[model samples]
Each structure stands twice: as C-alpha cells, then as structure tokens.
Target: MMRSILQVPAEVLSELHATCKLTPYELKLIGELCEILEPFEEATDKCQGDQVVTASYVTACVQGLSHAIAHIRETYKSKFVVTKQSSLGKCLAKFEDMECFQMAATLDPRFKLNS
Candidate 1:
C-alpha cells in the first residue's frame, strides 16, 4: 500500500489514501510532510538520485497524509443534531433525542421511514 501511493499525483494519492486508518500522531506527521512537499509538489525533479525511488518516497509520504485525514474523520464520527423546544413551561419538558444522526441511523422499527 505504501509503495503504491508514491508514483501517483496528489489527486491520485488522495484517492489511494482514502483507505488509510490514522492515529492522531500520524495526522500531525502527514501535515508536516505535506508542508515540506507543498512547494516541490509540482516542481521539476532536480535531484541526482534514482527518479523512480524518489517518486516512490514522495508518494508514500503523501499517502500518509491522506490516511490521516480519513482517520480523523472516522475517529470523529459525523453527528446529526435534532432540536425541538420543550413546552414544559406549558405542560412538560418531555422530548426525545431522535434527531441525532447515530440515533437516526438506527431508527427503531417503530419509526416509519420518511421519504
């Protein structure tokens, strides 16, 4: 997986990177590497070493960044918010937390799917 990422362009790298599961530290490292890669990403290679190997290394590094983004997003599950004002002032503060995304994802059989 690491080797596969290196020969691709940033967009391709991003696509490949979608699968990487990241921890927080990995994310920071990726950001740092990307900062280093920013100016040179589109620059012509002026290095004296093997071009193929260099390309591989760059791709792997970028892949790490992609992995981090995916990881963070997953770690922070997307939330759904539902809100309603309670009329307790008039009757009771009774309500349900049904609007939450996770809750909605598992809406009970009692819930009829809305189009």
Candidate 2:
C-alpha cells in the first residue's frame, strides 16, 4: 500500500501533495525501516508454534536482531540519515547484556544437551 501510494503519478500527487502523505525522503526512510525490522518479524514468526516452546529463541533472536541492525547501519551508508534518534541502536542496547537470555537458550534441551 505504501509503495503503491508512493508510486502514484506526479500529476496526481501535485494535486494532493498538501494532504496526500509522505515526502520522498519519508517514503525511502520507511522502506529502509522495514528492511531493518525484517529480522525481528521473522523471529516473531518463528516463535509462533504450538508444538514447541520458543524460549530458546530469546538469545538467538537478540543476536539475529543485533546483526541485522549492524548490517543496516553498514549497508545504509549514511549514518546521519539512518541513525538519527535510532530505534535500532536502542534495541541493540537492550540486548547488550542478555546473559539471562543466553542462560535460557543454553538450558533448552533441543539445543544440544539432552541428557
């Protein structure tokens, strides 16, 4: 929907620009934000199973999100553009000392030690 709306012809937007919606920069930023958030989305989907609990995924998910955020930071190039008041940076900070999550992941039987 956002992409389609962003793709509307210039003539249409010219008429409605006052009330229409996002500027080009805003559209691009949202697109980048979605890319940054994709790993978190995937992690959430992975945890939505009935047969098995996803407790072990806590550590894994944090690591995955951290890596994804780092990739976004590097791949996006413009630090000022991508990291201003960065939510991704804040999310990474929350996991910086996730020893509890690591312990939980280590305790899960499916992750190697089953005895």
List TM-scores for all candidates, in order.
0.22, 0.54
Model 2 ranges with Cα > 4 A deviation: 1-18, 46-52, 78-100, 107-110, 113-115
> What are the lDDT scores of the predictions, listed in order?
0.37, 0.67
Over the stretch 31-103, how does candidate 2's per-residue lDDT look in tens digits? 7766656676897886677887776776677667667766767777776436632665576456546777667
Tens-digit per-residue lDDT, 16-106, candidate 1: 5566755557555555445444433433252225543333233323334344434444443433100101121122111122234225334
TM-score of 2: 0.54
Name the runs in model 1 displaced over 4 angstroms: 1-20, 45-115
Return the top candidate by lDDT. Answer: 2
Per-residue error (Å), model 1, residue 86: 66
Whole-model lDDT for model 2 versus the true structure? 0.67
Model 1: how far residue 87 lies from native, Å: 70
Candidate 2, position 77, lDDT: 71
